[model samples]
Target chain A: MRVSAPVRATVQRLTLPFLIFMSALLAVLGKADVLLFDRVRVVLADVLAPVLQVAGEPIASVSRAVGTVENVITVYHQNQELKLENQRLLQWQEVARRLQSENEELRNLVKFAPQGAVSSVAAQVIADSGGAFLHNILVNVGSREGVARGQPAMTGDGLVGRVIEVGGRTARILLLTDINSHIPVAIEGTHDHAMLNGDNSDEPRLVYVQPKTPVKSGDRIVTSGSGGMFPPDLPVGVVASVGGVIRVETYADLARLEMVRIVNYGLDGILPDGWVPTPQAGRRSHARAASSP
Target chain B: MPYSRNRDYVGFVARMVPGTTTFLFTLLSLLPFPVPSFGSIAPSFALMAVFHWTVYRPDLLPPGAVFVAGLLLDLLNGTPYVGLSALALLLVRTAVLNQRRIFSHRPFSVLWLGFFGATAGAFALEWAFVSLMQVEFLAPRPFVFQTLITAACFPIGSYVLALAHRAMPALSA
Candidate 1:
């Protein structure tokens, strides 16, 4: 059947306005994380993640090649830097040895019971968050590999993010540079606790510190583990700039995140004994737990 | 345009090629390759596709596919608001769909310029939506860079899309 001109034009006019309304509703629902939409998103991600994994294969090797090229270009300067770093490391090694023995003896005398062994699953970065609004990465490991919500994901350098959504074969990590990311952290020298809040910029600000807190540039920051989301004393980063506005340079380079480890330090308070009857409830509880100071 | 009853299977598949190719290109952009700071500023290939197909062949790359493409991107990249990209694309589609006459007849440079303006508008909408959703003003530098880079990459997307569009008739039947 042939369509009439006026009717077709009316429908065409209605299309844009209708789509605009639906798009707004979707944005609201998605940001609010309405149950139905989030479930579909998670399921879709799980289904589509393998395509990402396959697409990511070339990325790893290409990055590795680029790394080798850079290494070769800077080998001489790197050697000189390493020579000086080696001497400093040697001095620190002796101090660490003494501290370790003393701590072990003190622990033995006090009969300290060490917790269970920390286990971690290694995963490849399959995809990067392409937009400016969110800084996230998709890893190949997921709930099937025992990864769960609120688990701290790290690289060899330091913390990369925390697992927010986990499917059977994939998980989404919320990077510390994301606007929504707020991590509880402590300055090394001052030992003052603060929050590492991401503002969608490279350097996340350190907030919630007392005015008298003696924080300085180059002072290290580590996970405070106050909220039970992460274990105590995980090295996060060093204070890149401290005066005026405190900023931390994360150890893990968000730009070149290749491999990640979802650490299972048995610190996940949301899912007690790996019991998640429903994913939405588990995620909600984790959010509630995360909000408490 | 609605899928007419007279349209053949081959015609339907041919119509879908542009959207599918754009979806794949968008997927390609998500890989974290070791480029110097390019990962954060990688161009929006999907936007380029939407803009291109909107100007040339809205019947093939319709609003519904554009919306789905945006949502697919959201799910893939794990954005906070899933429909922000969709809204941006829909707005871009609307913006271009009305002015397709001038764009369709303009020279290549003018087309590129048009893409730049549309991308700027779309990204502004996305950035505003995100800041409103989070209740804070997000830094504009990233989106600004993304818009520039995407416009610069427009020629490449257009070139490839032209090839796909040109090559479809041969494969359709």
Candidate 2:
């Protein structure tokens, strides 16, 4: 297996350029034909899920320790804040009780049909894309845990994002701040609909707003259920700014996500598996859906 | 003969240390760090590994290995552009190879400074490629932030690679 000096040198000289050219080609064409990459990514992610979880254990404990220390230092101040919050919540509870009875009576009068049961699974964040241009998290739960694509992932505070890629034991969540994310949302109270678009920033921009209602800073945004991808009225975020690009500050702390609930609202707005057999076709349909105003 | 075989085995593992560490570093970059806003701008540990090895032991971690490491990173991170990392890393290796003389036998600060330059180049290339693909000028703030973060974290990444490099003396080169 001995090679001549000229031949070996030629091969060595060409290797770098060849690989660079190949990579450039792949980068340009990868999005158009993502089926191969998707399969490889899912398998690789599933295989490495345990490793990521185990590696993240120390980080999780360290953050928890930091949180504990902070809580201890601020316990007295927190107690005062909690007491006032409790009093306010109690008043709301009384109001909610009255509304519940009135709503029940109205529902009986209208013979309204009850909504179906919603199912959800809790998943731990295992991996982060960690790229400047990407805002996705890989959770340690997937199809085996009943996780499905297009299901909303939320923290108790609010919507985090949606499950886009699901493996057997891992699912990747496209956070609300990812460039490709486009969730249909509405301003609270006004019910004026807009699209929440991610630009790889901490705050996602609110676009396609109804000109009739002026969006103001501090106005709440929630899922509009327009595209059927998400149910109506799931808490999203508050409008951080109204001028130039309307930005939303998500209620869920997407930056420090620990756990997310991927809930199946029983909505089938996403195309079924049979409709788009290939992953590329599925991605094209998704692109079309996201592009539509 | 048995003793020689044992020596060969040890030497083989020693040679593998660089490639193994690069792969591990790629995996390390993907681990979910609980720090606020850390995930989107996690330091490029894989690039650090490639840079370290390209400067110290380019023969062991060849272009092929670097390409595979980048591919593994892109696949594991779930980036839509499958080869962007590979391209960036290969370019880094090529650039580092040319300037290896400057880093060789230099103090830690010089290596760190060189790494900073490499980080800037890699991130700028990414920003340009992505903005071009997207057909709009992307906000450059994150790319700048990531470059600084990656450069700032180089000492740690380089220290880890140095520890692995210590085993290279055992290799039968």
Candidate 3:
């Protein structure tokens, strides 16, 4: 059926405004916590997710290949470096062993010891939203894998970031390098607390530190877990100076992130009251204690 | 006589091919890929698709369709408001439509220059509107890079669309 010229013109004129109106309505409804729209978004995401998975496969494969090559090169250099560092570490290890025995004896004598717990799960980084404005990664693990929002994500080296959004099969992690990402951290040497804030830059700035706090470059920073949003004592980063601004050089190298450990260091609310274990549990406890301390 | 019927058939095929191809290309642009060093950013694949269609087949790629495609992108990327992208796309479509006479037969360099101009205008408008809404800055750098990459890929996209146009014998003028 051929449409009249006037009718065709009318259809063309109405189309743009109609779409504009519908889009605005959808946005408003979404903001209003319309359960229906949220569910729709989720459903659409589910439908499109497989396409994303397929498109991402080639990129992931390339990254893995590159990572393997880089790892081999680094390992060769590290092996030689570790040979020398190992000798010096042996002396430190002896001193540490003596100090550990002395401290244990003192704790046993005093009949007082604090114990904490730790548990973790391995996850693959599937997607990275690479930019200073919003540093986030999509992990394969999701709520189905017991990955809850606000759970602390880490790399082998130290704290990576926290999970902010979770789907049934995927979760979005807000990395420590994002401009809006901030965490309460404490300097290892001076025991001073400061807020690590990302400013769309590689190194996140340490803010709110007292002027008298003896925070120096190279000092280790760990999550203080003041608000309980994250587990305490997770190694966050080391203090670095860039443009005279103190920033945390995070332990997880954002440039080469591959696999990550999503810590299930179960929330304190889930723990049994005043119950503690020996040795193994004690070690876990010590790790937790050291995390905050 | 029979030539009128043939022309109608050709127009029908031309319209069908461009719409379907643009839709699929737009979908491809939204796929999430992990960046080794940086986090995730959805590049504007739909923008490139729309731009190509507008430049070569404006009759098939209309402003209304461009607006809808932008809305889909905003939805998939989780942007605050959908109309912002739609508005930007409409502006790009209108600009291209107005200058189609000059650009329709231009060399590749001129076409690319036109693309850069259109993309920059769209990006600036998008950034301004998004910033005004107080939503978190999604970083324009990635989008800028994506536009450049899309511009680079235009020849390929154009060629593919052209092949499709040619394959459908009914679409050939």
lDDT tens digits, residue span B110-172, model 2: 999999999999999999998887767889999999999999999999888887798578565
Top DockQ model: 2
DockQ of each: 0.50, 0.65, 0.27
Q: Which one wins on TM-score?
A: 2
lDDT of 2 at A188: 91
Against the reference, the lDDT scores of all candidates come to 0.81, 0.88, 0.66
- In the predicted model 1, the residue pairs found to clash are none
Query: Please, what are the lDDT tens digits per residue for candidate 1 over residues A1-293?
Result: 77999999998778778888888888877644445555676787788788877877777778778789999999999999999999999999999999999999999999999988899999988878877766888888888999988899999989987887888888888889887677778777666777888877888998777577667888899988776778878889988997788999999888777789999987754435332223244345445444654
Put down candidate 2 lDDT per residue, A15-70, tens digits, no spaces: 98999999999988888777788878889899989988888898889989999999
Candidate 1, DockQ to 2 decimals?
Answer: 0.50
lDDT string, candidate 3, A220-255, tens digits:
998876656676688988878744678778888866
Candidate 3: give the clashing pairs: A116-A285, A128-B39, A128-B40, A129-B39, A129-B40, A130-B38, A130-B39, A130-B40, A233-A291, A233-A292
Poorest 10 consecutive residues by lDDT, candidate 2 chain A: A273-282
Error of 2 at B80 (Å): 1.2
lDDT of 1 by residue, B1-173 (tens): 34453357667778788889879887877877666555668789889888888888888887788888887887678775777888888889988998888887679998998999999998898888777766678899999998988899889989998998887887565
Supply the DockQ value of model 3. Answer: 0.27
